[model samples]
Target: MPALDLKGCLDDSPKFRKRIAVYEDSIQHFEFSLKTLTKLTRLQVDSSTEYSQRQQELATDFTSFAQSQDDPIIAHALEKFGKSMIEVEKCRTMFVSRMGQAAYNPDVKPVIQNSHVTETFISPLEKFVKETLFPIKELKKRFEKASDEVDSVLSRYMGKKPKDPTILETAKELADARKGFYQVYMEYVSKLNDIEAKKKVDYMENVLAYMYTKSAFHHQSYEILKDLEPYMRDLTGLLNDTRQRHDEETSESSEYQDLCAQSAVDIYNPLNAVSSSTVSSPGITVPYHNTTENPNKSGYLFERKGGRVMQSWIRKYFSIEGEYLVCSMRNTKTSKDDDQSASYNLRVCSIKLSDSYDRRFCFELISPQRIIVLQAENEKDMHEWVNSLRMVNQKALNSDKAPPPLPSLHRRGVSDVTPVIKLNGFSGSSGTVSDSDKELLKMVREKPGNDKCADCQAREPEWASTNLGVIVCIDCSGIHRSLGVHVSKVRSVVLDKWETESIEVMLELGNTIGNSIFEEHVPSDMETFRINPNSSPIERDLWITEKYVKRSFVAHKDDKAQETVNQTFWDAITEGNLAEGLRYLARGANVDYRNPNEHLQTPLHRSVQLGNEVSVEFLLQWSSNVNEIDENGWTNLHYAANSNNVRLVLGLLKRHAKADIKDESGKTSLDLAVEHQNVQAVTALRLFAFDKQHNSSPANSLDFGFREAMSSFKQNYSFERSHGTSHSALDLRQTKSHSPKESSSLHETGSKLLRSDSSQ
Candidate 1:
């Protein structure tokens, strides 16, 4: 490169400070803008679909702009600008999410306060100011001082002849100083030219063209705060009377509408529209990805032991989908084509380090009410699972449209739920439904609104889904039912029998209520066609599957309730599920809980009547009172004595149950056993009564009960598996069942029972 003429005419004075001050002002403005954005971000106006879409659009735009930069300095400037903008967006998003949490949960502290703006947004730009712009400003002052020294020397030597010795010496000094100052000016101009073109002379003119676009985006984003922030109550996290913006999510975005139209269960996959791409159950899809970027694993997870089921490792496929980490279970028995792939909508899934005390290489995959702990084969696989899931969790959090939180189905067919029109007639009292039911029915009868069929939006819909609680037209009901009862349990409003509490569930979860829970984050705002009541089955099937099964339009709630209701407390007694009862006991429920609607009887009384010998044993293990009476004055002994189950009767008796307790009819356990002609039960009780009669000494109740227990144990005793199963075997019948002290008590009781029998 040829050295350009070193002559510089630019003046050196306090005037250069004025030029530098402008850049300082710009830096301050940028920092202030970032601070403002950080403060605004905490508002969490996630309901605005346009803003969310715009955010993604901005990211793509930034990428393209960065790519287009050719000059090194300008590229670096754009790069920093893009990064700073991204940081601002990130800070804003986090703030909104925190604000959203605070809105729903009073307990969660407000998002990280003003530091959100200061830390992520303002700090970065301020650093840029200090490192880049401030240095340039300081150098400009030095350049001015150098220029003044050269200028004064040159003026003193000007108009003097070369023969003058003073003039010649001053001229030599000015030239050397002028050369150094020229270099400083060029370097200063180079840095300033990167962020702004101040003039074409600053650098190659085209180098800063991209700055205009960057500036425009920042201005647009900055102004957007004014439009949306007022509607958000918690930018500062002050108060309430707030409601979720489900309507905004549904009514405004066409792109989401397109995604909804495309994502049917049969023809589409929320993971992608490939058929049976991965092994998955309803809402837990681990999608199959072809790219090397995503990690795919066929692994195992221990599903939490639920009602009457023990913990078992389930085989599953795990995949890293864009912004979503999905894990799906596989079933070998399923031959259906769709079942071959991951059919679950794992949109709402999340991850955490395992709290598992016993297992190693484990982490938890969480969905709405469901949590699964997965164990990797080794540390490498565990890290992979953790890293991929965390990335997707973060990715999904950044997205404006997150997948719906689950209990979502993956079956694609015409198993449409009937519209929940008429509340079931069995709504508690007088063989009638309540006014709430009537009001809901009246609303259902009104012209179709947000409450209409989720698939076709058909008015006068007739069926409902028990899980999602959304009503569909009768035509769509067939489609939902086709997905099978596991996917969506379709029920009728006027035909099927309904539990009073179930009716209450429907009442509390009508269309609007259902929308709030399932459609909290709406994917699209486009209106969809409602299937005519007479539409073809195929059409209804496709629509229903797309709407409910794939959950194309469903968005995960920012603030869904995570509290487990332990509803199984009542279900255990009704179903005689021992595991279910035990789970509640472990969760600290009352073993003596009486179901007021079920004759005010505790679970023990119910278990005995139902002949659930195992359930009764499990309930008793929790220290339930065996002699507790129910509404009819029938104790557990009374119920067991009249039943055909000899095991249940024996189990109760071995627990030292009171045989003399009377029912309302003055019938004792022996009386009921004999009266009912229950052969085995009668024999057991007769032996107990005979033993009692023969041993009529002045023994305390404990001794008398112990003797009866010995007789019952001897009668029912069998040689089953005698080692691991010993303690599991009922009470005294357990082979090698007791310690020395316990054995001595049993031996003494057995001897007494033998003496009583012989005496008799």
Candidate 2:
């Protein structure tokens, strides 16, 4: 559109107004279009960047697959394909980068002296809208105001008599208003003209720049792909040949039909399936099985007596090659790299089924040098492995060429490995330790500071303090046991059967975390205070006592007033904020801080009363005596039982809360639980009583049956909570700051309800 005439603006005619309105509308449309373009451009750049990243990830996957391939030709072809894909990904990544730069700043320029200004650089379209269009809107507003003032002044001047004193004043006001109107009108018209020209030229120029950047990106990508054309064609030809060879092998396999006729569960052969491309047949896929005639067999198996003293079983990759039984040694933190692969001569070894052994799927390879015992995953796997070994051994014996002589076994010290997630119970709990324990043991020992003793830095810590979540040497464990269960509950990682929750506790806080907490403030100058691997029993005892019992090295905050610290502690407990509570505890907030306003209940008591087990555990970690009594003589256990929360009751007992301790009412927690008819809570308390009778550690209370019962109960309880099922006693209530009288009244009402339920 042509610019609105300055002369027309001076006339202030209806025609001029109409023309200006059209220009203003066009400017609004232009602004909207530019915003849309900018938004779409940003989205396109983001999408392209994501696409490039995904392609790069796919290329990496291709490279990994190539490394795992057995066929040399296929592997080579895949490697070439992977490299080409990576190159294409790089091109796409470059394109994304260029596109982003083009959208953000089409014209590259040297950054200014100030880094902050460089970071805030606005794109061309955005800059034009902000710096050019916004000011034009402001000018238009000023022009309208000036025009209104001139019209008002002129009307008054025209209304006055020619000779009147007011006539001269009105005329002078009219002239001043008209002059201001003229200046604003000219500026507004000038801005309108400038923007109109910019809208036509600048926008087209930006579009041109976008097209150029896009064209350059496509050309670069094309050139990159063009370079790989010959290699891609060759790879395709090689893949075609591989497919033809595979077809030939499938057709010539005499055992394929026999394998298919066998039970589907016993054997899987995908070659027996009807092809999807068959015109008249239904596409039926069968289970896949390798049909190669090779007698070689390799897979993961449990190797007995592999580690030191032959006490632990270790998983090893076993493969039969010719007459040698090759075992791949894994690199664990506890294992050395001296023997990466161990080979046993099958020609001199006698294979026998271990049907008489305690463990299922056991077999023994009796070699002239040493007996190599192995366990398979199942009976079928075991038989298959035995058959493969026998076949290889017989073939070796019949060969005209003499086999290699028997070699000595290279024994490495293997730590007892266990699974982190417990699949079965042990010792104080029910059931024998399963083979799943190996991985968990390895995982725990591999944790930082766990490979060595937490106290003496002894290699391969076999014992762990369950409550403290630290692994220690056998010698250190004896000291930990002496410190009392409340200080550190010790358990044998290998010997003791683990509960899921206990293992989770250990995994959550390994030796690294334990040392970080206990030895947080250990002085560098006091080297004598720290015990080494060579430290004597007396030195270790003194160090352990100072570390766990005395907590001499624990960081403390003495700066905060006792009142402020106690108040913060109460607030954290009330809000169920474990992190904040732990922080304040380190800052000298008493874990046993009594809330005077809430019947002088300690943090632990209050947490149980509020049904906050998480906060209760947090308090226990900070050494909050679970046996501490409230003003009403109610302990945390008493509160937990009265609440009828079975989980909470179990947790308290596990933490060594005195279950037998009587309250002011002359009733123990178990008595209260039974009176309230809290069946789960009562059961938990009774089982705990039995556990205390049989076991020294209160934490190891649940047997297999009881553990299963509790597990089921927990699942059901969780389901109820998740689905918003309401329970009168177990419902978690929101706690608020209340006056002493109100708090007392609330507790009284709760007590009355419990009494009412018991009486009924």
Candidate 3:
């Protein structure tokens, strides 16, 4: 690469510089014109469809013009200009889409015939001022600042010459300076880029704040305005009064100067002296007491005496003639006696009052274990008396009694003794027992004679106990019986697992019957052996491992039995059968039974997905927990909606099934109906949403209910009639198809109805 001289390139020609300047000027004018035109067009356009089309055209034109420019600086400017145009267009589109044109456009001519064209003409100017031209002003200021900086640099380098330098000389000097200035200018450009990025963030924040503030103002404007009315009235009155005072101040008269002076002496003199003396003066002396120990503790008693002393001192100092001499007290203490067993401790303190130039006193006496203050007219006098009584008592009380320590574990001994066993047994010769024992013994010794029917209380004399201890009569008992059916049913209804288990166990124990001899002397192996018929197919195929039991029963070995079960299952599902299927399932038939090579769907799934309403309803009634999702990740409602089966959707929704369930494509039943333009299905989904909103807790009023209904109708109408399809059965032909008289008649009728509805 060649190392080109930037200085030489700059110094080449003044014409080049002039060309650049002219290009910038033209670009600025072009931007302003384009902005103005855009605003005018936006104001005029009534429909979003037209606005979007116009915006696309504007973007294409600006982009084309930018691409046509060859100069790098001009091209860069054009690119920025195109971006600004695109941004404004985008903002316009967003505004129209969110708020609609009716909000942005205002009627300009009420006197003339009502028309949108008048409002449209003024829109371009509004847009230019609001969006485009306002931003341009800031851009112009920045450019001006940059131009000033460039001029300053040029002047500094050129110096104060006698005359203006020649264009060539000036260009050469600027060109030389431009090399270094460009580097610095580039830094400023980088800073501007940072500022612009921050401004974008700040602009977005401001827009959000403005939107929130506008919403809040809309909600509270009435209340705020109402509150401000009274304050505004009061402010007006005050302003008027101030103005009157200002006018009259230049025309006032003075009088009663002597009377004012006398009133000042009578009232202000005493008040002034009181106010001045309220705060303590720096040099004012207050009576204080010093005692042997803690004299201030009894200072409250010296308050009156201190006041008298202060009055006396004040009178003496000021030479005022007053009968009462209220002076604040000094110290008042007496010496200790030689016969005293303890020392006296006095306490004293003072409080300065702001309302008067006097200090209140406090005094107390302290001993080794107790404190006492003497009551007097003032604290200063109390302090003197309290100090004299300080030696009365000063000693601590003593008592001697210690608590014992806690005992250790090793010190506590344990005793071992066997408890006597009292066996309550039935009377057998010498072994005599009580009546309760006899009853218990009989219950334990007697055989479970009969298997009691839970429903009728009928006893079956000939009965046998299964391995599970369920007592059954020979007639009712079957080889295929298992505990799984009962367990499953119990688990389904009962919420607590442990509680269900306990109930099942108790029921089994109560129903079981056994011979008395076997009950009392049964081996552990007998209890461990279980004849489980409801075992899984794989488990049923295994041979019995117990050596004691030589043979095991296998129901599948009988081909008739297997065929009967399969036929029963098929018949149950075919007849839209719920009871038969549940019976078969409970009887240990294969639940995953298939017809042939086709993908196997369970009886529950088939009845739910494709069966008649009665069949589905029957299946649901039989098994409340048959929740099956199909191969397409669709529930029953999805299949029903896709098939436009309104009744099925209603049934499923009635059963609390979700309508907005998304399929494998992430499309819900509503979305699918919308995609297919199924009016009935869409209406059903919307009605469901409306009902949900209406039936919500804390029911809404009639207006809200009507509004919700209307909204639902509108939404469904839009969805159905979106692609220019007639929403209703009414297919009224256009007026153009008839004569002018017919067209006029139709227009008049339509206008009347519109007016009537608008009035309502």
Candidate 4:
């Protein structure tokens, strides 16, 4: 028996043709009702005087149409058709209810009064129902009813008749009717569904269009409001309130409309057929399984299996780009304990449809339980499958036109530009000296004070106070000293003086001391002391004729004045020029001469303290004692140690300078060197001391030897006292025992040695 083409019967047959006629008639009524309702709404909104009377007439017409239907099938169809009209009424009631609420609102009154704005807002809904939604709805009902009738008639005939004779006979007789009915129904529904889907697409497009139009309208309203500012006192308030309400309502309504339109389109759109333009097409098909049977009792053969049927059909009709099959299975077993029945699986395959493999095909299992499969031969076929499923045309999936790329959101801002500061003048607050302070500090370091202990006074050195207020020489300065209470470094110690007065008094005292202590002397020939001819005449003449001439005159007249002048010149040379300064010492100038203003360094000590190696060599060569001590009890070796110069220290030691000489703080040159980590200086000092000890003998002269040995013993004792012993004092005592008389003598000698070491 041949298969029946139900689509043809629905389209062409005359038998049961009245049913088709009734369906068409009912659709017309549905369209009329929609149009009537739309017209009534417009009339009412337009403020027509007879709108109430017209609405009454429309309700009567709708009731008459519902009552006129007589045939049960036709009546049932009409009832469903009427229900659609009732839905329109329900929509109308909702609109009226919203409008009534809007009318009563104090906010919306002014918006309603604006004729332009109100009309613009109502136009889209009016156009939508009239042009798209109503027509689609009417057609959908008509075809859906017709399709149902055809299916019902065919199903009854197929189920009751025998397949061998009655079935074939009946099917042939019914073939034309069935085909005609189905053809009309499918064509109509397909077209209706297309229209409905297009309406959804149109809705989104219209929304975008409406948004642009509304934005422009808002701009125009702003301009109008600007021009009407003088008359806007109450209207502006109402406008603001109405705008708020309108925005909220429009947002909600637009959302609802979008969802409804999209749903209708998604649920009804028909799958499109594959196009023949492509050589190879992409397609997929899935077979339905028998859900009603138990897996063990079904007797389903492998060759006759749904999967095999689907695979065969796909291989025969579908062509894809790939060779391998991709299949997904959805197991419907309810639990772990449930029987392992036939699994409902969807298999997709890609078959090469062209020699170039440019085109492919696909297939899908649309209804697993019904054994229905959907096939696609190319891109168009894929679209058809998507359409059959009533899915939205996901813009993301479309190949014809690519989606616009999303805009970039990440970027950086310009950098900050500010200025930096440069520090100068002051050294860091760590108390390190600036270059100027270092110059002054060097001068102070060269000279020590004269107001020392009797023994220190004998040394006749000048001392300056440290920044910490302790009086120290170059050597004593290396040792940490206790800060004394008296401010002796200040020139004057006046008890009852103001700060300014004290400063002036100090300056006067300093000048008095400087003038008294540093007197001028004259040379034998005035020409030798004459100002240079090339020098600035005024400045040179002033110094030569006034200061130098007066001092010269005083020197020539008095012997005391002459000696004072000689001392002053010697002091000036000692402070400034070490070479010229040495001439004074060679010419009977005191080696230990001290200036009044602090730092009373002898020529020898000053040279070493100033880090003047040439001057120091000159002084040492001139037979200046290498062991000479300053006012702070610092010897020349102490100055070398404090200077941190290993060459100068070795030079001094080579000249037989005592390494163990202590300053007022009781630090020897070796101790000071070690404290400062001057390793070479410390080694040289130690070697010199060792050499001195090695040259001395123990037996030749008992008394002289005993005295020398006693001196050595005292020197070592004083060294240990000044610098806490490298070996403990207890160890020193235990190692050597002497008679009480010798011990007493050693103690006396040790005290004297300590004093002598401090002085030199």
Using lDDT as the measure, which candidate wins? 2
For every candidate in turn, the CA RMSD to the true structure comes to: 33.4, 30.2, 40.1, 56.0
Candidate 4 displacement at residue 675 in angstroms: 1.3
Please give, for residues 1-760, the per-residue lDDT of candidate 3 as tens digits: 1122334233535664454345345445645655666555455444643565466566556656756665433343344444444434433433233333342232321122212222323343344346643564465455456656667767765674556557567667677656555564444334334334433454345445435433432323232233233323433443566578876764442223433433433223312323222323422212322243332222223222134354321111100011111122233332232112222221122112222334333333333454322234344344444443332111111213232232221322211111111111100111122344445333322335334521112354222222222333211221112222232121101111112112222232333221221132334654444324322212222212221122222122234475467657756765755444544443455544443422344454455556355555534433433334555666666666665555556556656778766877897777665555454455556656666776562122222333333333333333433445332112323312222343233333333433333344
Give per-residue CA lDDT, model 4, range 273-301, as digits (tens): 32223213212111111122112111111
lDDT for each residue of candidate 2 in 285-333, tens digit (9 for 90 to 100): 2311212223677778887764554566778888776678888766555
Task: Please say which candidate is ahead in lDDT: 1 or 3.
Answer: 1
Compute the lDDT for candidate 1.
0.50
Model 4: residues >4 Å from true position, as ranges? Answer: 1-563, 566-579, 582-587, 696-760
Pairs that clash in candidate 2 = 417-437, 417-438, 418-437, 418-438, 418-439, 418-440, 418-441, 419-437, 419-440, 420-440
Given candidate 4, what's the lDDT at residue 35? 64
Tens digit of per-residue lDDT, candidate 1, span 457-545: 56656567654445766446556656865456665564333433344334434566444433444444433433454444445666556
Whose TM-score is greatest here?
2
Error of 1 at 427 (Å): 19
Candidate 3: list runs displaced more than 4 Å: 1-571, 589-600, 608-611, 624-627, 675-677, 693-760
Candidate 3: lDDT over CA atoms?
0.38
Candidate 1 lDDT score at position 151: 71
